[model samples]
Target: MIASLSKISSYKSMNPIITLSPAILGALVVLQAGLNRKVASQWGLSAALLLNAVVLLIVALLIFALVLVKADWFSNTIRPSIDFKTFSIWFLLPGIIGCILVFGGPWAIAKWGAAQTFILLMSGQLLASLIWDLKVEGIAVSYVRLLGIGFTWIGVILACKWK
Candidate 1:
């Protein structure tokens, strides 16, 4: 674990682009949430999710085809190593959770507006991420981190204020 942490730190130091990727993803999530809300307003939640799913499927397929053509790595190394017997049913939770995220995001945006929804979503994500880091990864939870989480909750409350 220490080796992995050192490796990640080294890699981050070497490639700053990896650090900036999350910020880009955060902006994209906000954009996607707004677009999802608009689509939901026109087509309803289920139809919007379905449409998004279809679009994502098409894009993923295209990417996969390109990867297959450009590199023999996945086919030669990754695909051949599949062990179906070792796979658990819990592996499917990501898709189920994704569906929930897709459905709930637009609903929250419609009910609360984008700013409030984004704040609440970010708060929830921060809290969950902290807990996951501490409990699952056995990371030490510092006082500063706790204080940050408290501030995030306060922000969520302020954002949720009806007035």
Candidate 2:
């Protein structure tokens, strides 16, 4: 277990894809936020968010089906094992938070403009993530990490500043 934990901790060095995925997600979220804003303007926020959730559910189901087939994941001898007892109730939080974000994101962009909203969102996310890392993960807070957070806040401020 210790060996695997060490390996997992060093996964970024082993897999560049893992490190780059979040950056790609950040770009996609910006585009998604803009597209969602347009959809909300035409259909109203609740309808737009409902439509978005439905589309997302369809895509996810399709992807899951494709992966299952490609990997032969449901083969008799390769059945996936799930331990419901070991699963934390906290696992539900992300889905709930995601729903809230999907519902509120377009409204925020409409009210605050995309750039300001995205900057504010990013700022909050960065701070929350830093706190999670430091407290929940028991990670040491370093000067460099603090500096990066400081720079992120500065960028957010500049992005949202009025001329």
Best by TM-score: 1
lDDT for model 2, please. 0.82
Per-residue C-alpha lDDT of model 2 across residues 13-73, encoded as one tens digit per residue: 7668777888889888888878888998898888888898899899988866766777665
Candidate models: Cα lDDT each: 0.83, 0.82
Model 1 segments more than 4 A misplaced:
1-16, 72-81
lDDT of 2 at 153: 91
Each model's Cα RMSD: 3.7, 5.1
| TM-score, structure 1 vs. true | 0.80
TM-score of each: 0.80, 0.77
Summarize candidate 1's per-residue lDDT along 1-163 as a digit string, tens digits. 6986898888767666777888898888878878988998888889999998999899988877776677665566533345898999998999889888888888887887888888888888888888899899998777888898899888788768853
**lDDT value, residue 82 of candidate 2:** 64
Report lDDT (Cα) of residue 10, candidate 1: 84
